[model samples]
Target: MDLLEKKIYIAGHKGMVGSAIWRHLQARGADNLIGSYSNDLDLRDQQSVSDFFERERPDIVINAAAKVGGILANDSFPFEFLMDNLRIQNNLINSSLDQNVERFLFLGSSCVYPKKADQPIKEEYLLTGPLEETNESYAIAKIAGIRACEAIFKNKKKMYTSIMPSNLYGAFDNFDLNSSHVLPAMIRKFHDSKINGNQPVKLWGTGSPLREFLYVDDLADAAIFILDKNSHHPLINVGTGHDIEINKLAKMVQSVVGHEGEIFWDTNKPDGTHRKVMDISKITGMGWEPKVSLIQGITQTYKWYLQNINSLKMVNMYI
Candidate 1:
């Protein structure tokens, strides 16, 4: 089914990735798209999700809602990351299958792979090793979601696809220092450092670990690509297929925000993994690649930060 006029439901419509997907779909002339905030619908309840499916009966489902957080948040709240995420995905996927929804796109993170998995991580190396201790719970939940989609596809040839996106940053990103991911947290930190007379910014770890990031818009476009092509692969990695050191990333964020602050690395903080770079051959082979460069994506995020400074301030209230 074409995106146009198809009833599409974005589970976490208010979040960075979900909001980007909704906007991309609308921009592409997709009508009949639907979404609900947390207040209107609690995804953790089984009956609530079942009733939502009965009422909305959406044609496509994008399972983007989850209790996502940074390493610190995940380490602090393991149960919430595991239980809440499992509840949400289980309810949504099961409900979608019961309704025989034409397509279901479940969004998983790159962290689902084992911590010591081969560099340039491949989808096939999913359970080859151990997960990063800091975020294992969240990763486990996402792995389950990926496997569920794989099961649906292998057993019934259904259009249940999973996309394991690399680090994403763009509009609607949670900027709270406690819960936000590395990119957004860096943006927030640099912005504040500049405002506070360019105070030295203290970052975690020894700044030697490497990581990759993808623009949320590029991810949104990939979602459209998957929906258009109805790719049947169980899982595909979504990323730039490149990486940068944490120190270099800090410098980039500092340059973007015009912060002249001295960088401080506290070696006392644990560097969860040495490096994680995704092999994009699977998705690139499918003829889809990210367009936005890392610097451009960061610039875009900083601009959004400028415009929504007030909301950025209030974001901390949630933590």
Candidate 2:
């Protein structure tokens, strides 16, 4: 199948991951990409989503829409994070199946794995143990999505693929201190402090948790590469297979932002997972490797944050 000629629908095209995928597709001369803002279409509305699928009849669908946030945001709105993501992905998957979409790409997060899963997490380790309490709701929703896609592919012989990516940060990332993820939140906090007389930045937890981050654009490239190669694994993990401690990551962001502030760790706040990195051997063996290094990705993200500081908006999940 010639992907460039296919009508592809990318849900959540305005957000960080979706926007990166859209940009990558455009750069690769894919001109038939389709997306709509929340105002135009509410994915949670089953009738609306069914109608849209019927009307557009896209050849392929990429499920990238979700209600995402850090620990505090997830804890504060667990119901919304769980229900909204469930609704959005369920609607898209059902509608795509009903429309007989040729191929479906469902994007998931590394959090789908168990919180205490073995380090350098592998795809087979999913659901082996409990999830981090803070983001359990969001993780359950994503797990449902992955299972849905897997069932569809196994039973209906459809080409539905789910890609689970590690912590992603890049342009268009949410910098809102309230709901943003660790990387962008760090970037925003450091930058803000640097401008505000380099006030001491207070970070959550003990700064002892370990995390692995992948550049959003690299995730975009991996998704397309998987599709192009016709690798129809039920679920594939994409990451750099590297990890870093929170304290070190914060120090890196501080250096990148040139913030001359003392770092303080708040033990009261939850640290969430202690360490969550991906075992990317599957994707790497499939000939897809992450391109951007952590420091380089952080620098680029900080640069984008600075360039769009004046026009940045609070990134909220679409219902």
Candidate 3:
């Protein structure tokens, strides 16, 4: 079905990727894009989620929200990462299917690939080996979401597609050094170090792991591409098909942020996976390619960080 002006509900519309999708749809003249904050909709509750699906009855759905955090948060809250993500995804997928949504898209992560998968991983590399222990719980839940979408696509020939995006960062990213992803974490570290008299920044691991990163807006563009194309892939990898080492990433962030401070790596921390590149040929074959290069994306993100230094920082709420 043509998705122009379709009632589309993006579950995690406030996030980096979801927000980008929302803006993209706005520019595309889709005036009916709808989203609700988790506080209002509590997607983790099955009955509530099912009721919302029935009530909204959106023509299209994009599952982009999850309990995303860094290695420290994941290691500390494995149960929350696993159970919350499971509940949120299961409720959304089940309710959307029940409501007979015309097209559904589930956003997965590259961490679903095996920890030791081949460089430039492919869609077929999922579950090929052990997952990285740091984010295994979150990764497993995402894997379940992908499997659910695949099952629906297989059984009903539905337009249920799952996209595994590489590590994403952008304007609305979490920059909390303790709980944010690597890119945002590095940004915060460099920013703080620069602001506080250019103190040397201490980073985790040996900075040897090779990783892939995609800009969140580019990911949103790909989501729109898939939605507009009425895509039917069980799983497709979305990335720039490139990779960089952690040390190199740090240097790039430092350069972009104008931080002249030295970077000190604490090798005591685990480097996690050695490499996690994506074989984005599947999505490329589908005519969607990432437009933003890493350097360009990082510079844009740093500009955003400079613009919203006070707001983008995540503050943990205590009860």
Candidate 4:
């Protein structure tokens, strides 16, 4: 199984995580990589997905496409978050199985774990308790995707596996304040405030929640590691196995962006999860570990944000 020569299809090749994987694979000299944008192929359409799989006949498929957002967006559009993600992953997973794809890697978030799961959440705690109300719909959709991949691997004897990553932020991230995740959102807020004469930045929630974040590039490397090893683990967790408080993270981002502004915590808003850290022993034991530290990753992300601020603004407007 020379993956470098196999045709690899990354479903969300244009996203932060998918693009990172594409870049890494290219750097690794993978020849025969394939990808399609939403305009070219709507993953939600079963016939369209099936047709694409039939035509492309990819030897490997990485399911990275999904409807993603922060708590505000998830709370506002639960149905779209749930249905759209379900449709996209379902079409891709089912199509890959039917087409006899050699390898499939499904990517999901740490949100798939229960809201009140033990700190440093482990894989076994998956459906032990209720999910956070704000993103329950999205979590349910991801849970279904993980279960689907597990079922196919167990019953159909396929090489389909799922990796649950902690909160990810890096290049190509969504920086829009209204819909972006906490890390990128903090970067944007700090950068904007820094440029605006160090104006006070308002952040959502009490800044008390604890979270773990992985750089998108590290996640991509983990994906490639799994592919190369042909790991048969039905589900694995990918993260730094470290957690930080929102308030501390805010200060870190503020320092990275050089924003000399006061950060005001909006107690009115909701902190979706009190603590959501992944137990990465499974992946780490398999010779894969995150190389990017939070501060270093944030530094790079802020640099990218600075270079692409105008383009990001246009993207937000279009969205």
Candidate 5:
């Protein structure tokens, strides 16, 4: 089926991931793309999602909506992190199955993998061991979502697939320090410190943990590529197959933000995971590659953060 002619519903269209997908679909001449703000459609509510599906009758559904945050936010609100995500994905997946959607794509994070897995985590390593304590609840919810899609693909022979992306950052990313991921949070901290006369910036953790990040738009492209492919794999990892230490990442973000401040590491804070870099052979072998490098993506995200700082501040207040 041609993707352009189909009605595509992107849940959480305003988020970093969903917005990127929405723009890409629009650029590809997908006029029937559909979305709703949380105010208009509470994805956590099952009946509302069902009603929206019945009314729109979309041919395709992209489940990009979820309750997401950083280590501090996840630790503080474990219940919301788990239950809200469970409710949101459950409603959308159930509605898509009921509507008999032609294609369904579930977006999950690399956090679904185990904490102490191999250096380069593989899809087969999921559930092999324990998860990071900081975001265990969020990871479990995502695991459930992935398993749900896998079950549908196996039993019902439906095109229900899940893409597990590495840490993502780009335009429309959550920049609130309390809840934003490590990258965007670093970006905000450095920029704010630079603006404040290069004051010393205090960062959490000992800056020893390693992480792999992907540009949200690159993940969007991968999503579209995987959606159009003829693969039978229900789960695939999307990443750059590269890892960077937190200290190096901090220095890079400081340079990008042009911050001349001294960075102070708080050793008391917990490092969520020692290292996490996904094995991207599955997607790259399928002819999908990430176009944005870490430095390039960071520079672009800093530019966006600068341009939208005021609005982001306003949005952070309520988030």
Candidate 6:
């Protein structure tokens, strides 16, 4: 398809994952990249999305926009998380289909898998059982997006596919405690505590849940790899294929941030899911694998956070 010559539109180009993909594409010599901010174009508005696609006529569409957060944010704003995500992806997918976009890529999370799915969750485990209650609404919306791509690929024979990534963290990550994911949240908390006289760092849940994290850039690389190959897999899992307990992750973040404070666990809080890891054999077999180790990724992420701490402090106001 000569992806470098195609006009590509990344829906959430400013976000951590999307920005990484955009940079990766640019580095790969994709000159005709396109993107717009929410103010310029509301993805939830079908007419607006239709207009943008009709006007831009991008050859490839990457759906990376979504209302995402941690357990607290998701639990508090379930409706927005569900409806906003559904609207954004629905508009993008349908509009691309109507506009006859050459290729489409939908980014999803590991949360799409069942809460009680077998260990080392595989692509087939989706919808096998109930989802973790904390983020079920968001998961449902993502599941719908994946199925939408699957249907189009199955019937219309288009190159629409979904990539489910596990716990991504990197540059441009949301460090706002209220809405950020576990990894970024931990980084922020430990950093703040370290600077504030090493105060005790209180963390939610029992620090027992296990999670797998992939650097956002790795996900971006995977996306580019798929686009270059024009792979037709309906859905593929992108992750490190390994996991660590929350307690161990906390210790690592604490060390990275140089926080010597006592770690306190809030037992009253929910752990969300006991374990959520992806089986990356599918993507690995396709010649794509994560290059960043957790320690290296976290070290780089912490460095970014330090450089952007002043601006990040204002993030809570928006949330």
Candidate 5, residue 287: the lDDT equals 91
Instruction: Note each model's CA RMSD in angstroms.
Output: 1.2, 2.3, 1.8, 1.2, 1.3, 1.2
| lDDT values for all models | 0.91, 0.91, 0.89, 0.92, 0.93, 0.93
- On TM-score, the stronger of 3 and 4 is 4
Instruction: Write model 3 residue lDDT over 167-215, tens digit each, in one string.
Output: 9999889887667889988988898899988999999999998989999
lDDT tens readout by residue for model 2, 124-223 = 9988998888988999999999999999989999889899999999999988877889998888888888998999998889999999899999999999
- Per-residue CA lDDT of model 4 for 1-319, tens digit only, reads 8889999999999999999999999999998999999998999999999999999999999988998899888999999999999999999998998899988999988999999999889998999999889999999999999999999889988889999999999999998777899999998888878888999999999999999999999999999999889675889999999999999999999998889979999999998888888999999999999999999999999888888888888768422
122 in model 6: Cα distance from truth in Å?
0.8
Number of backbone-clashing residue pairs for each candidate, in the order shown: 0, 0, 0, 0, 0, 0
lDDT of 5 by residue, 1-319 (tens): 7888999999999889999999998998989999999998999999999999999999999999999999999999999999999999999999999999988999999998888998798899989999999899999999999999999999999999999999999999998877989999899888888988999988999999999999998999999999888777999999999999999999999998999979999999999889999999999999999999999999999999889988878867522
User: Clashing pairs in model 4?
Assistant: none
- Which ten-residue region of model 2 has the weakest summed lDDT? 310-319
Deviation in Å, model 4, residue 11 alpha carbon: 0.4
Off by over 4 Å in 6: 317-319
For model 1, how does the per-residue alpha-carbon lDDT over 1-319 read when each residue is reduced to its tens digit?
A: 6677889999998888999999999998988889978887899999989999999999999998999899889989999999999999999999999998989999999899988888899999998888999999999999999999999999988989999998889999988988888889889888888998999988888999999999999999998898888675779899999999999999999999999979988899788888989999989999998999999999999999899989668657533
Candidate 3 Cα misplacement greater than 4 A, ranges: 313-319
Per-residue lDDT of 1-319 in model 6, one digit per residue for the tens?
8999999999999999889999999998899999989999999999999999999999999998989899989999999999999999999999999999989999999999999999899999989999999899999999999999999999999999999999999999998887889899999889878888999999999999999999999999999998777675799999999999999999999999999999999999999889888899889998988899999999999999999988877655422
Candidate 4 local lDDT, residue 237: 95
- Model 1 regions lying over 4 Å from their true place: 317-319
Q: How do the predictions measure up, each by TM-score?
A: 0.98, 0.97, 0.97, 0.98, 0.98, 0.98
Q: Model 4 Cα displacement at 290 (Å)?
A: 0.7
